[model samples]
Target: MVKDVFTNVVANLVTALIFGVSAYIILYIRMSGITQTIRRVIHPKQRVFALHDLKINGINRLEVSKFLSPLSEHERDILVKFHAARNGSNPHNGSSIRLDGISPVSNDKKEYTAHISKVGFFDFIATNLTAYPANAPIRSFRSQMATLMRSFRTFGLIQQVVNEVHKYGEPKKVEDVLENRSLANIISVSVLIVDATGRIGIVERTNKVAVSSGNFGATCAGTVGDVDFDADNPFESCGLREIKEELNLDLERLHFDGIVVPKQKMQPIFLYHASIDQTWEELFPIMEQARDISFETQAFYAVPVEDIIKFASHTRMTDTAAYQVWQYAVKNGQDNNWYKTLLLPFDVKRYLIPWNSQKDGTK
Candidate 1:
């Protein structure tokens, strides 16, 4: 009888393993689209907090173009102001998150001045180390499982649930905050590359980007992340870091033509500017030198800004954030000069604009 019991146990173990493997195959085979599609589901855009909900971090030299360390005080604030949340992937939306939950907190990046919650971040700005292969998803199921080990052990979550989280490009440490969605804040950047000759730099993304495979977008745009910098400037860190990773340029070596601050009247709030030192003639060579291999870019074009406007209507070049930069640059002026528009009424206190400490101290 004992022998029969042991035999049954062994059989059950084998069956479970097989079932797990089969489920993994079905899920991963769909590739990165599944995760990005689900992200859209959770982070629907229209649900934006009212203008009052807008928390603006002031802009500084980092927004326009500076690569040196000891980034200006305003630049550091960009990355430092926002809280970091592990970008996890879970299908369920509208998860109930209470503000007055277990208030257990000490100090995290010093942004915990007001609201505090028991949960942590479940969203992420993927690091360059999480690079993809040319045009493939960042990783396959086996790889994500390896990283999820920490969470399984720490959070006491089972393989089935943790596996979903990892597969969705989220870190497992988020398991602690999985039940708390209110703490999540997603930060991303849209880079617009303009050369001296009035040509804008854009790329056709490969399947590696997950959601916008084959879409045309700003030169080397990406999102902000905790690893990008310990400093406070999110926009500067996000843009500069992405440039280093995707374009392979040494920030110290970059030549800045001038700062181009997008005016609120005509441009999206997210658009920030810094003209690269390289001229139009050298833009292609610079692009060819890109070091990040985890991505797949079909082509980099140095077409006239006007031509890009013509292509703007085409679905291929429709990354709104990036496109707005073109509108701001071309319409505001030709190129090669620092420009700033008077701060608009709506953007007075909520949006980050290049500010003068002595002049615009009203806020």
Candidate 2:
């Protein structure tokens, strides 16, 4: 009897081990492949899954001219109509500024910086999406996972890999969001929020959060999205995403890359310029619908650029990067008084990083 019991126990243990290992392997593959990740996103019981569209391109392929070439006449017409209907004005025709060439590491000596290869930013997801198609988020998804998959975001594979390496270590698994081997470290967009008054929108970060919390900074900011990755003006789409997520407000017109600055070990800040044409009292009700995705904001304030400089003079109340952009826009707007309202037909030449010298002054 004792012998028989020992054999049965061994068999059960082996069966359990096989099942556990096989489950992990399947989960691993599903996480890495875009098509395979559907299982995690479809169920109602699952945690919220953000679908990120990582518009990863190698450094060599990111030619400013190619990305900024004039839109086809039809696309241009569509964009014009789209902006007119939504933004109430036509954006300036001009060159675009990009910080794509900036290095993420502060002291790394490499002349060029691209995504870390191990995580797979270079690998392409076989998605059928083309640059900016006129479509909205897929809301038909009945499940949380479906919602995430349709949310339309792209994450850098390199950052995703470094952040998830530890999850693959042991067989014992607790499912963390990053452990999926898909989600990556984040990049962000900072919009110099403003209104018709030409006032810069600022927010006080909650003291409890990480990084620049409690500091006065751009309240309108977030990661770049999937559609904007390959569009004629992708930066503005990202600006819209941050606005929708934080304030639930989607202003029609936006100017991309009002400023681009790379900080130490940080992705260059893409400061897209957008001015909302509304009063603070009118804005309060609109802001109430906001999801406040990051929970980082304490309050909102709209102050004129000159006032901000004066406030900073005494107390350093400005997000320094955003401050520089205010100066840039003011100067670029010049005698036309366009900067005061952040009107369209924005001057792209003024905003480019000093290294990228593109001379097609008007888009």
Candidate 3:
């Protein structure tokens, strides 16, 4: 009887071990799937922000590819109208381009006189007083037209055009909209949180602090500040300032991953990332010794790509800006895994490391 009992106990233990491992593998893969979904959403925005950031750090080839995909239905339509209007195909359908100081009119008529006047956007002044009639082709007219087109696109002419006529564009008082400048004060600082895979940084919290937080629930966050001018571009300067203040991280060594800005927001944020390969012995010492080592108040924690979707699905993440960041992370994470499977079959390595990990190398 004793021998039979021992044999049964051993068999049960072996079965338990197999079941535990199987459960872990299933859970891990499910988490990974969730992560991929997050990345796919985040990737496009990051790519765009990176392109706009002339001095952006840490951009890689995969991110570049995602950004170059075909424009969405709405974006394609807007682009078509914008391009056509600027080219004079249907310029008369919208507001005068003259407001942007880029009059599409050329001095092809030799007898026409030229006059200069400074006008604000949407304000046009036609000079009734002609200075001179010239036989020589006036270069200023063509130059002005080119300048205007550039300004129109740069200053978001497409939005203005669409807004002027759309029901959604009904003349809005600043008080009536959440997009009013007043909301700016609440989120005075903008942070472009990012991850190691060039994905937008995200975080999940059941606490109310996240709900009341300025823009998003993200672990690695940096506020946009004007304190320094190390880089000529705003995005680059902001990125550097944020890393220094928030993480006490030196941007010089971090690899440039990509920049991401969600299309829905007015003031864009740029995302950047770098890979860390050192063991805990070489890693924790440096991080621990950093100037601002505390994470208690900030609620800062790096999220792996595998857990992105779960983080994003929280009900408390209702802030539009925060939601955009979450969505961006999930989409881009998946897109990366999808392509990796096709390009390199056997190498299923995770390149992303969360900012917070135990001293002994556990999360």
Candidate 4:
């Protein structure tokens, strides 16, 4: 009897050890998968293309023309219903600038003309909310719309409406997509502010914003509203207006770096390198008094130019913001070897506008 009891105790001990080990292995595998998924969502694959060969020196170098296209019946209905369901109230149907097409003038790659149209803000919101890539955290835009429609108790009808409106018709080139009139392509400006001491100013966006909330972005950015439309220099005026609203400082030395369109959202953002006369130390107190600080920015960091790539490697940044930093670094003669030292999240394809392709609307 004594021998039998001892044997039973040993068997139980072995069984418990095996069970614990198996459970631990299973948990580890699950945790690892979750970590990878989170990483992909945070840093989706992005491709940024440079629209101009030379740095656009003057504000007037870019030209604009108005080309309006009224929204379809289905789109209009989606805009109204989605806005009401999402906000629990009527939508703000403000005016916004939509990018239609871009063409170089007289075979000059440096000079270009942008065709824009006025679109309602609610229309942009309705379309843009479902414009994310397939691999995004929220899955494809179709899935997201389906979930929202179901939650709003209009699943069957709204799903059919959205399906028809948001169809990715064919596999087209990037240039074709940019000029596609069907998409709600809004034009926005991203200003990268460099203080007198050569340190780059980066701001952390708060959770109040609709898109890219809690992510690091440019110093100040906003859509091209009606107030920002200048007959002579609309893009420049938009950039300056955003800076004034977000930082409360008037910047006169803004240079158009280039235009970048991130593949994730497929939105073209005009990037400007703005220089401030004050050092970051002196600018801090003034920034503290910004009218929109509480609502837009959570905090600010002054990073030296050399540490930009390193800083970006460890921190999470919006796709446009990260590309802006990389473009600035490259333009400033930063060594390309440094970029290879660390693995970056996005792939940037620099396409120079060929002379022949300019008139044909080809890249």
RMSD of 4: 13.1
RMSD of each: 17.6, 19.5, 24.6, 13.1
Q: Pick the candidate with the highest lDDT.
A: 4
User: What is the number of residue pairs that collide in model 3?
Assistant: 29
The lDDT for every candidate, in the order shown, is: 0.38, 0.40, 0.33, 0.61
Q: What 10-residue stretch in candidate 3 is worst by lDDT?
A: 125-134
Please estimate how well model 4 matches the true structure, expressed as its whole-model Cα lDDT: 0.61
Superposition TM-score, candidate 4 onto the true structure:
0.68
Best by TM-score: 4
User: Candidate 3, 278: how far from true, in Å?
Assistant: 4.3
TM-scores of the candidates in the order shown: 0.41, 0.40, 0.34, 0.68
- Better model by TM-score, 3 or 4? 4
- Lowest lDDT sum, 10 consecutive residues, model 4, at 347-356
RMSD of candidate 2 to the true fold? 19.5
lDDT assessment of candidate 1: 0.38
In candidate 3, what are the lDDT values of residues 1-363, reduced to their tens digit?
A: 999999999999999999978865554443223433343344233422222213322211111111111223354445444333333332122111110011123344212111111111111100100000001111244543563455455345334433322322322321122122111211112343453444443333222221122222443444333232223343345555555644555655433332333222222233444444434224434555555444312333344455443444332332333434444554565433323333333321232334455435664
> lDDT per residue, candidate 4, 63-174, as tens digits?
4433222356565566556444443344456777777666666455666666666666655555544443211123344544554454456444345434644464532444
Candidate structures ordered by lDDT, highest first: 4, 2, 1, 3
Supply every candidate's count of residue pairs whose N, Cα or C atoms clash at under 3 angstroms: 21, 15, 29, 0
